[model samples]
Target: MKPLPPTLRENRRYLLLRITPATLEADERELYFAVSDAVTALFGDTIAAEVHTATIVREGEYLILRCRRGREDTLCTAIATIRSVNGTPVHLTTISTSGTIKALRRGIRAERKGNSIICTINEAERTGILYADEKIDLIRRDMKGQDVVFLTKDDMEIFHATTTITDGI
Candidate 1:
């Protein structure tokens, strides 16, 4: 089968969003449903179909969503209405929007340019990464599962044995 030519192909835009709290365990399917529901709820089924919202890629706490190019505004509005996914409270902040996947991927790389610091709190090991505004994201993994904690630099300093600065993140 022949593929559609560039001019005949549907125009789409990719939106990069940063998921806050950044620790939600929701999978791609859950995220898609959440987005779909938000769009439908805000614009109804017909408009939702017209928007054709889809999840293109999910990397760590960043998500790339595809939607009809001209409908991006409506989609962004819908995305803002999404407050939770799978019963867990989450906030999605749109980082950037682009017509090419390459540009969006570059943005993701730029956003993840720093190494993470390792810390030991109450004898449990956790990996910490510094974010802007003096915020830190810590992830602790154990036999049970993974636990993610977001705290300020001041709060993290109170933890015990948080002196190690691991190399290569």
Candidate 2:
């Protein structure tokens, strides 16, 4: 009998560093700087050197950042994105939320209840949902007080906070 070929798996390690929540009215850019500084301080000049990309996504009520590393086979080569709510900066590492999500898409339980939806996201992912509806409302208002983007009942299952209309007038 022929043996199955060994599948190549990337040998990579990641670390998640979470920051405490700060005040709500704090500046977002400033908070990002602080979180970046903290990440640099924690990982030093070696592993956490390159920051490939950073993106902000709305999860439930909170804003989550996904930071992608340049390489996948290095120690401390990971992403760190943060959200500042009520003057609090919550740092979420790629390993904790993103990794977990990648591991168990079905394991992370979620269900809808009436007008509200309940998702069994991890404690860290929960950060993404923090202040979710309000933040989206703020963003919508900031976008000219139009209902172009909204949170609907179906969005609850996907953990997405904002919805947009590209074809509608």
Candidate 3:
């Protein structure tokens, strides 16, 4: 067989970390830390610096971590955006109101859209209600025959979706 490319090899190694769920919360935290540490150890200080922006998502019993490391220009713009928003009451108010309206519309649309759609659950997943980019709205879980109301909104869209948790390691 031909040798795998370097990127594929690296991705394969990364995929190895996705395994079965731990029984304890501490174990889960430890696993997350270990994954963060491993990324730093394998990719050096640059990768380590970007780890803070990473998010660990939990869907049902599975855990996944998503990392986004940007280039210099992207990082600079992000920093600038953060700094610009600091202590700016008017700007903050405008952003907040716009975001809230967008989220409300998305929720309403999602509710009217579909039911029981399949979703891939990685380590960085979030359950209950999810508001995305102040636009798209997705409801992650809905159990049947149970009084479990995962999402509720008077003027929001609600869509049904299923989450599939897979073992990696």
Candidate 4:
């Protein structure tokens, strides 16, 4: 069979997801299933197939999901509904979506060093605080038990103080 031409190839996007409950095992298959179920339940099999999610990478607390280019919004919606994987309560936070993997990696790296950060309290609800332009002090060596998650600009705004963002959500 002849391979399709470059122009005919499908455009894809890579999404970076930050996983919470960091203690849970990082199993690619389980992560894929949780994502698959969320999309299938929300949009049915037709849209689910159209999305074509692929779990490309799983680091300590990060997951790189690949999906059809234009379906990023759909993917994000599905991701938001996910509550658990393999009965382990978890949170999936969408960091970014990029058409190229190189760009996606760069964004994730920037996040690791980015000035904004979210500090999560060690509790059942896992309360979090979104801070602007600051991170180093919160994660200092003396603060041995701190749980922090780096976030993107969008996330920063979403999790920002409600008292300040009085504008319509």
Candidate 5:
């Protein structure tokens, strides 16, 4: 059978979700199931069938979900209900919703480019990468240990170039 023409096709919307911690590794299939379950449990079979959410892209800590255009809100609400994936607790923050994947991908590129900076912490220089929700992850020398610091973009001063405030100071 021939594919449906643009005018005959159903309208769809794409959602970009940022996986919290940015380190919790999850499989695409597993993630899809988790989302499907959330939608089904929260809205029941009828709405779930109408939404027909699908995970189209999974890049690093980001996931692109597609659903019928009008059901975007419903899908997002279902996504908010998800608490864990494969036993790992995680929070999926909806970064943006777009009508086209190209636009969302462009935003993701810009997002990944500028959040990193070199700063001094504990007299040692570390690389800090900021997340969408005003959180920063400082990478250690060995890259084995990372500390999540909850701070906004304006709070970068905490990691001063030459000095760090100590508890006793």
Candidate 6:
């Protein structure tokens, strides 16, 4: 048996997306169904079949989707438009896209201190605990390896840590 030639082989594109309001757990099958349904509903089955999606993986809060090249626009649009999964409202935000798996595997830029990310809150090395009613929002990314996470004093009912910088992300 022989592998297909480079020219004859299909070109693939990878899309990185984040699911917000992390109320639901990561399930690839359900995510796939949601994405497929969204595409079908938006552009019909013809376009969905044409997209030639190979695989979909849910890593943490990120959903990495691999599909045929030249169809990234369609796939990205479908992912962005998907409102809910398993009755939980999830907002999908595109993080990055790549043509190769190696490139796609490279995630957020940060400095690693042992295992966990070197998170600093209020200019302190060790921050305090978070309350159940607290809302942690992104203040701003000042440097390449430093991330400033602000735990707002606002009392919010629904608070979700939807994004996390991790391995294989």
On TM-score, the stronger of 1 and 2 is 1
Model 1 CA lDDT for position 43: 99
Best by TM-score: 1
Ranking of candidates on TM-score, top first: 1, 5, 6, 4, 2, 3
Q: List model 6 lDDT by residue over 18-46, tens digit each.
A: 76643345488888888889988998989
Local accuracy of candidate 5 as per-residue lDDT tens digits, 63-106: 99999999988998999989888866778988899999999887
CA deviation > 4 Å runs, candidate 2: 1-23, 51-61, 69-96, 99-169
Name the top lDDT candidate: 1
Poorest 10 consecutive residues by lDDT, candidate 2: 121-130
Q: Write the per-residue lDDT of candidate 4 for residues 1-169, one digit (tens) a residue.
A: 9999999999999998888744456599899999999999999999999999999888767889999989999999999999988765689999998887778776554333222233333322222323354322222122444443444335434554222221211
Question: Positional deviation of 28 in candidate 1, in angstroms?
Answer: 1.7
**Candidate 5: 10-residue stretch with minimal lDDT:** 160-169
In candidate 6, the residue pairs with backbone N, CA or C atoms under 3 Å apart (3 or more residues apart, or in different chains) clash, namely none
Each model's lDDT: 0.83, 0.35, 0.31, 0.70, 0.76, 0.64
**Model 3 segments beyond 4 Å from truth?**
1-18, 21-28, 51-53, 69-169
Please, what are the lDDT tens digits per residue for candidate 2 over residues 15-129? 2333322113334455445545545665665534554223343232233443443343232232333344333434444324344324423322232112222223232111121
Q: What local lDDT does model 2 show for residue 164?
A: 32
TM-score of each: 0.71, 0.29, 0.26, 0.63, 0.66, 0.64
What is residue 112's positional error in candidate 2, in angstroms? 15
- Comparing 1 with 5 on TM-score, the higher-scoring candidate is 1
Q: What is candidate 3's lDDT per residue for 1-169, written digit by digit as tens?
A: 9998857642200111122111113344554455455445555678556544332443322333333423323222332222111111111010111112234222222222222322323433433232232222233333531111233332233333344332321
Q: 74, model 5: CA deviation in Å?
A: 0.6
- In model 4, residue pairs whose N, Cα or C atoms come closer than 3 Å (at least 3 residues apart or on different chains), thus clashing, are none
Q: How many steric clashes between backbone atoms does each model show? A: 0, 14, 14, 0, 0, 0
Looking at candidate 3, what is the lDDT of residue 95?
11
Give the candidate order by descending lDDT: 1, 5, 4, 6, 2, 3
